[model samples]
Target: MAMGRAHVSTDRPVAGRFRPVEITHRETNRVRWYADDLRTGRPFLVTRIGLPPDAGDAVRRAPSRVLRTAGIVSRLCPERTATVVETAVEGGFLWIVTAWIDGTPLDDVLAGEGAFDPVRAARTGLDLLDVLDAAHAGGLTHGELSPGEVFLRPGGPLVVAGYGLTGTTPAPRLTAPSYAAPEQARGEPAGPAADLWALGAILYALCEGRAPFRDRGRFEATLRGVDRLPLRAPVRAGPLTPVVQGLLCKEARERPTGAAVREALARVVREDTGVAPTAGPDTRPRGGHSPALLCAGREVSRRAVVLGAVPAAAGVAALVLAATRGLSGTATGTSSGPPPASASGPTGSGPPDSGRDEPEPGGRGAAPAPTGPPGSAGLPPGYRTLHAPEGFSVALPAGWQRLDTSGVSGLAYRVTFGADDDPRRLAVTYSERVGTDAVAVWRDDVEPLLRRSGGYRRIGGIRATTYRGREAADMEWFTAADGTRVRTFGRGFLLGGGRGFSLRWTTPADGWAEPGSREALRTFLRTFRP
Candidate 1:
């Protein structure tokens, strides 16, 4: 059995810094305190896990392993992961300090709110899957996941805590025996599959108001039940019944893969939100052009020629292409004639007829650009400025390389940048066949197609704008990409004479407002030179 830390006076500080103010939560082998840092005068949560006296090597390595794993996960998901500020091990106890989480623990929520509806539970399950996907991709397993470790903020996604606890103790199922996988109960090493079992338990608890395997009043007895007893069918799981049953399978090998689970959860979200799934495969090319290009003297509709000339202007086509091949393509407009030397020179026509009033150049009511310190001034560390041969420059984070480029013979070209495995990307496209009204292009040509995407939600009305003194328009919207919700911000403007440039930035929808994401967006907008 794990030893428990002895009670200390409230006035006394731990590790000469954290002063325990009150006990916030307690579990079988762990306890959490609402504490204050005496040195910094900041409030933080302090979690102390009791270690057996004979823990030996596990005890010696617990602090470092916990801190290192926490650091890795924090970087991958800054918004949804708890940031561990400090860790310490002394006298049979391992302590972890983290910033104050402005949310209610899942344990508390279940205790107070009872069983959740299928839709809400599915939303929470999707968030968990996303975190797990990133962690597993990075070669990490959160073996200690439980309802107690998940925090739910009002109007925000869940934030996960208690990473790096899988290997900290010698005994299997040390903290939550009822939630542990059958493999772990049998003394086998826990892995990603074990985490899925815990996720299943959490989902079961959310839908039924109790864990699938109820505790038998003792750790050994509960673990034995987990290893041998059959899972009770969930009565209130509704549409989530199959997923819960699949994940809780006693044989880890029989459980659903992460990708499968993600797809299932995405389907649930779509159903609940009334968003129909895509009807068929998206065969559109990345550049949005048809398979056969138009030849001289060939009869073609004006719209078809314009669309084929610059595939990027086909916004719906671009969305479909992004879904098929990751979001890593450029968008550009093209003229009827052959390619030109400079696509960014000038385009004198207004946007295609969309029945909307076109704003005059330097017009009033132009959407104001985001204000901040200029030109990468507020960029996060590790980003450097990139000067493109195409006469534009922007700052990008380290590890972002040019992923791909597309163009029409000579009239237009687009360059995309990011690591191959990265989910986010930036696309810069220049074209000689631009419409005069940026707002009309987005409203009339772009949005009609974007609406066809699942869960497509326009964040705001298209706004005529100016970028670097040129006529521009800004459009923001949310859509799903490969089962992950994604948000995109596009700004397209004309230099003059039917020539223009467009910049589009995309990131996971759940992380759009994270500090790092905000910094990146701000930097891209402030520094890009057309």
Candidate 2:
């Protein structure tokens, strides 16, 4: 189980972002339990219980909109060391929790800490583009970055934790699968340059802690050398390593905005606070107050950290400073808000198609996308689109071909409708951040290189039909040198960490010994959410 943990004397839920408690009722209308979240000790899921006395003033305006989305995610990285809270559990459930962060997430600390330190991992990739330039300029889009949502917490009481922002809103549920991208991991609609290609695979895992491409064994053909690789200056002290090789360019409009990635991480926090050498760009001293003002409204700290700028409507009073504590985007560059052009690109694409044309830095047309809003992209979200992450719910499987494309409003494609000769062996996938359960991935670095190919193995199966708000597990696995052992399944839903996630799948059941592999792994984990 490699480094795979789960027993420092168990507290439970601490596997991947530390899982804790999440005991939702029999779809008894979600909620009824969301008791704790003081930085992920875990609990919060009042996914809107029974409605009427007329939706009780919309569940009293949802714990103040999940504490104003954790006070606008702590004023967008006010020096990253999280803490967002909002709980109203048991029956009329509702929750919003944060703070179980502590270093090691540049995709699992660059797999083994190789090439980064480059100015402190280029100022932690410009403090994740200054909190994704205040959550896509107040629209939010951490679609699901990786390295388990890039954390790094070095020194005692330090910071840098973004653990998947409760599945971001307006419509989001494509958790970071190996820093996602290839058209949002073949599902789609992941903006903010797919969080700049998971921040250039965390600057290729800071020069090599563990990223260069995935699915191993030939590693997806080395991503054509990461879509035509070419980067140099790599030694360490990660202060924006030449702007994280220019925001790890694989095209998303050549990369840089979110206030130029927080002004290239405030010039590497003014050379890690020695604060002297000045002639070209920033040396500090713009006095309102400085001496590394520890965390308060956040000015800088975390080995010279200093990202500030959060007001895309900062709510829940930014969680009273985390007891307290804390923590952008664009193609290569362009900030000052207003750009995601309403989730740009796909439906009836091209004849004037546009994701606002950004790419060019690394050329080769770098992943052109956006396929919605214009002609309604591929349609869905029409009926005034409200789905919000309140509690959460989803379930797909019926004949399986529901696409509704164009800039996907929160996710769910459902294919396996493949025919033209029984070719669709068994592909039952599901997507739903129905409210945010926070997915932490890098899938154990692509499951040990996809189990070194000779036919993978990450199994578990038999038994099913257990439903309600949901919390399930079942399996039947295979990858058989080529047999692709059919009926497989995996489930661990709790989608309320922020919005929803913990989804799982696998289907190719010709064998795997008997009982249609337990009703096709219980119809792929019972069609999922409700």
Candidate 3:
């Protein structure tokens, strides 16, 4: 049963049709090859996996079992899972043929790029959890999930392979023993929890640059290590440390459910604004097809592919929770206490709103010129630096004191500043999770919600701009609060690593053009530092 290492003959086509042309990737007991369909002259990825000698009737039914499982999973996950073209069993080996994936394997990406930053890894983990969530919900399990089975497209959702081969043999796991869950290592039935464990292992590998359990030379030995070894603490997982630890819990019952994992991963994705788009070597086969740029009617953003199916409420909650927690690490707060987070404050005091509003003073909402050097320096008359305990500092008018503090504790926070009864106010918001598109955050996410608030009128189109060399956007609007018309100018900027800040300056709509009011907007933007 080719147990030691999988071997394939290059002499002839497998099933008398598919011919292996090049070795693509290899795991403990599996090998992936770039192959050609002799009859169709089309390129494909064919995977060969070893089977136990005593597999008995399972070997006879392997082809059908693989096909059935693959079909079930493909329907559950759609483009997120690989498309299985055919399955076959010959010479004590099971062969799986799938359409050529137009991307690099996850392992190959790690090899080429070394250990990924925690933010990028969390983004990938979120994508993987999406497929797992769908499969588990449909009562299916991905028996063998490892970096080798995951394919990452440049600007699209990742595609996973090796769906149906897990139960085709009596052996607990067919390949990548290091990724096997403890139950699988003990020769017990694997369930959705097992897939979650593997998902954690993959996340660990992506951040640490190695599998949680090292693969011993022999498959049996590797499984033994997985079953008995103590896990090495993940030093680089950062905020994802808890998630990796929760999923790797020895008892399957103790591991977090797929939904819980999704929530945590999504939170991480939202909080880390520094994650650049995932990049890797060009692994697309010669004459191979390019990956589809459009996913579910929207063009994929270069940062990450957000699942369209995720509940809107859940997304809003993530933002709210983040803002409620505020930017503890990267945020500045009053000395009395740190700022808490949320989404309900006036413009620039919380999240910026997008869409049409009254025409701006400049006719296009252009920001006025700076009045002083950045920080507390060269202040015009009575301005002073308000140093916040949360780690950011900004210049504020003499009468301005922290008006409100709201946040969720860690996700994000917003602090408003104003005189007790004054019509002018300044709001500073720090968020750990923010979209790369500053314009979209305002127009798409923030604006829709603003429209529902009382008498909200936008000034102009959300304008894309740069602040201190970082990607940023600006929006202005008017809103009636307690029968008073207030004009607010908001500017939000990204600081990478899923972290960002927004400054909102508000005053009586009729008094927005006063020299003092104009200076406050410029001073806040120039002096603020997270």
Candidate 4:
């Protein structure tokens, strides 16, 4: 059998009672193990943190401080924070023992999946703010709040860990320094406001698949960037943009208070009906595993619940002309609106009604010659291969043809294909400027712009997947065209060297489960080649 992940180098019993088993989770500077209490024969979660070698009196008194702080916070936030069982200092490390929490760490979830949509991110922020509110009211600061410090229980509930370690060391922050507040990075004392900054960093990572500031590999270098660098504007935050930017203000005093942050997140939850319902009381035995994580009391497959952002949400409605638009300098031509049925020419500039048959500059026509097999192999009925001059090919339905194409030549381009009567569309986008991380590109670059389209609601989280043996990601969502709800499934794969291609298949939401629609999508992904 495969061995479990090990965190500490030795298997020696801690405090001569608790014995570390295997590492259950890991973060920047903290590690959690599935440990056992030798005396009581009970399982526990023992978190280990390294301490400064020469902290003198502070190092000696760390255990007492931890117990005192945990007691204060637990009384204020009952059932929302981990219950500390014991603490001990041994071998220059502080091991905190707590009741085993039956949940997965938030960072682990994000790493396995990808980024969450704005609605879900806002809801999670609200859940986190509840714990912060209670702790702040009790005059306690969770200075080490990070993705690792938070756990997402089955059924959409949240619990926080790692309290009482705020002043354990002389360092401003220990683990996950990328989340340290600007003041904390500068060695200033942390307070409630600093926790708000960490909350903002978590929200940004949820929405964009990355922290506001990149980790510089070295601890000091990362802290310097957190203190000195300006935050890159959040693109996928959408309505939550204001709240994230506000909490990340360099000056702690400028960050929004707990009440303000709560209200903003609540408003977003109220506006978006996609929020997962809060799970009811869990009756599972302590330290026992559930067959599958339940969400809203439904018995969904673990893959569906873990990989998806819960069930798909009903998307918004809007006729977005951006479907045919490409990244700047990636393709040629500039035009808006879906092409008319009879229109058969290269994409042109100006309004949709420009009535011009502008041919591509390089003697290309409305439908470029196929560079690959002309016949559909292993394709659905009536599908044929139409290769493009832009170095990619895919199978299209018999009546389908190039409806619109746009982009700057040699950089990036987007080509849309569809039939006049069919509401479904397949848009292929190729870009040399695309980022290496497919999840980041979808969460940070594409979704933000899509949010601008009216009535757009993402169905699930951005999921990391593989396509044609390349690094790829998939996103599914709902949008509207003339009051009709439409669903779109987009898969983007990296071609190495910052180049990538994405295929987006859109159909009416009502018809998404139809056999034809499902088969068409599978056929597209199977036959597409670059």
Candidate 5:
């Protein structure tokens, strides 16, 4: 196994073709090996083929006469990556194998690079859609689809790897917080539509450069983030706003097919942009450009930025989008690290590193330290949490994630933070709820709130926009709160009557902590029942 400094390891692939179809029931699905390793080539484990009780029998019987009976459906794999090796009866198991993919999975790509550019992201998405459609034609279900199953070839196009794998092999529970389809989490068998939702998530990440949902919560929360949340994309992610939202719909049936998704994305390029898609694997266009631009299908916008130089067609598309719609907010980076971090915690907030809990009191386990006081244990003694004179009380993090108090006599609060992602981002914003129309209310309220928010920080116009449907404002400026040095983009939305309810999603700059604490901030937001 090749182990890297990052603690990840892998085996060097050898050229051969045999694979282990890890089915659920060895008794019924077991493929009595007619040949050993020598004759079998290389072995591949089908991560999943079916659910617990039935997978083994299904897999074992697949090689029997099922394939012939099922017949060949759609062949979605691109020619370069794989050609149908013909539905084969290997040993006693039936399976589908393209060329072996020996590259990093797309899941890692997202974790490493906050998200991907829209063009490339869309291309990969549609490619998978075609594959799924092909399989659907065969009456087979993908069962599971996530970024982890996607593999981005160095020089080749992105290819999905796990097929028939998830159905058989037992899938471990997903613990990390990231975008996932609603059905997959519930243990319900996933179908073609599920795959489309997965594709939309990948596209969202590519355009927005971050998982649609934060991992702060568990399975249900993740489902909500993917299925329920309508928060806008970050300001800089302007081009892809509609795209991500469109893809994140709760109902999978609502999402279009790979062809439709490709067509819609292409339309974004043509209508919003007006250029051909970037070159394919061979850098050639299949046809001039697919001209089926019927986007009444989705209401959200989507975007893909070319990290390097994009195809000439992409530029034309971007120009069209800019002319018709509008290019998103622009942010230039100093060095490209995490977004700026807030230096101070809440006043009387515990020591800056208070949250960085040391060994617990006893060798027993990690114990929570008293942040500040009992009532303000998470908060500081004299300092306040994010409280509105409107009878709202939530436990805000003491130090890193603080409320912006620079408004008129402390009428409002601003918190700034960063996230480690590509196109590096910073979120800074003023907070309050003035009216019904979220956007309009935020527009008219922040200035006056600032007046009530007492402070000496220079007041200037905020030059940012909302993310999702949350009312927010932002600006790229040196934070006057904690002078650790960095560009900042802030946002927050107050719901309910009289700013009694509010929620915030801050992307802090790297290295910098929150105005208070991240967890505390989360608790404060979670406290909101709505």
Candidate 6:
């Protein structure tokens, strides 16, 4: 049985909602409770951290900041972190409630199992490195990582907690003084480098069966030792000694990056386990037109487009891509005709085309066809055709140009296009890695991530349909940018055998129903040829 600093009487509820059952774990200023939600009658893990008596504004703002950060990180790396259910600050206590995780805390595992072998430690290090890579790419740092914050599922990956607790207290080392980096102990701001140091500390604890810097009787004393004393050599680290030493360096500038750490840990795992490192999902073309051509579109890949503008939006893109395996075999066609008067709803086949010279919705007639090039014959007025070097082509409105392109070598790539001062953009993403069900990819895999976006609300439920005579799904949602509400329509379809393509069109929500926006969407759907 574990002992806690704070006792919970059975009759008294902590926040008038959670009924504490037992103390699961406890640290210097933190306690974990196995509690039940009075409203839902579901079990949850509630953690309470003591705040300083004179926390000032931190007391008022920490609740929202912590919740928001937890939400963003949970969506970005769902498998790597626990889902935060709620947070509150009352009576000098910051209460964080998360979904009950059925796993053993790393601290408990260390206590019961003693030191882990080098291969096991290296494997755990790789998992931590991947999570850190995602968080840092999104500009977040898990500054308070320690053995107690990590939980290992029976056979699943590690899940981290205590993400939003950093920077909430005045003291540099609020709870875990021994884990603080040298810079943090010196009263400096914690950054990505600090996370690296903490990772090293965790690695050390796993192999050595104790923290690099043992906790002194006082917090200040331990932090001082961390700031001044050199790291003791690891006696049982085996292959992990080099990485542990590299990460525990006192000089923050000399620490290796997350990528470097991943490489080193992977090498160690391979050398010790006698098995090659597992490869991630393959995004390479299985069997398509060789030398894929560039396609006309707007914005860059989801990362460059949304991350460049709104950092959190990258979470949405990453979630969608990571959920699926390869691109579908549903290839688009080179059909051409007059644009639809209004945007058609989700359809089962290629985009509907009309030959009539009818006026578009919102009282605007289609612009006259541009007389610039030969392939432009079938394009709508003011639109021209672009054939990319990647073996794909599409028609784009005049003034649209390729903004950016990104992907792994020969596996997957995304091309974006738009013009200066344009509020609307289109992104074409091709992947050799996608799942089987187009609808499930959108609903189960992508929507959870999108929910984290600010002002994110789906226009309607995800609709299953067909594109270019192949299985597809359409999802529409609204988000805010610079105080302007923006809308996006995504069409993802399978091309068979783990190959797929997705077309995302975004525009100002206020103009979503206008003639021009409708025409642009219809034209792209009709002209795109994969």
2 versus 3: better lDDT goes to: 3
lDDT over C-alpha atoms for residue 8 of model 1: 46
Measured with C-alpha atoms, the lDDT of residue 159 in candidate 4 is 69
What is the Cα root-mean-square deviation between model 5 and the actual structure?
18.9
Per-model C-alpha RMSD = 20.8, 24.0, 20.1, 19.3, 18.9, 21.6
Counted clashes in each candidate structure: 15, 92, 32, 11, 89, 34
Please name the candidate that would achieve the greatest TM-score relative to the true structure: 3
lDDT of 1 at 224: 88
Output the better candidate (2/5) by TM-score: 5
TM-score of each predicted structure versus truth: 0.52, 0.23, 0.54, 0.52, 0.37, 0.52
Cα distance off (Å), candidate 5, residue 408: 62
Candidates in descending lDDT order:
3, 4, 6, 1, 5, 2
Candidate 1, 73-130: lDDT as tens digits: 8765555678787788755678888765534566666664477777677767766766
lDDT at residue 129 of model 4 (Cα atoms): 73
Model 2: how far is 281 from its true place, Å? 18
lDDT computed for candidate 4? 0.63
> Where is the poorest 10-residue window by lDDT in model 4?
361-370
Query: Model 3 compared with the native: what TM-score?
Result: 0.54
**Residue ranges of candidate 6 with Cα displaced over 4 Å:** 1-11, 279-530
List residue ranges in candidate 4 displaced over 4 A: 1-9, 274-530
TM-score between candidate 6 and the true structure? 0.52
Identify the superior model by TM-score, candidate 5 or candidate 6: 6
Model 3's alpha-carbon lDDT is 0.64
For 1-530, candidate 6 gives per-residue lDDT tens digits of 01123443445565688765545567667777656566644446778877766667877788887888888787667556777777887666788887765444666666644787776777666666656656665677888888778865422355788888778766665677789899999988899899999999999998999999988857678888999998899999998899899999999999987657777877886676566555222112342311111110111221121111111100011112322322211111100011221122232111111122333321112111111123554345789988888777778999998876767656877677678777777777777767776667777656666666567776545544444334555566666666777777676666667777777667776775566766576456546666
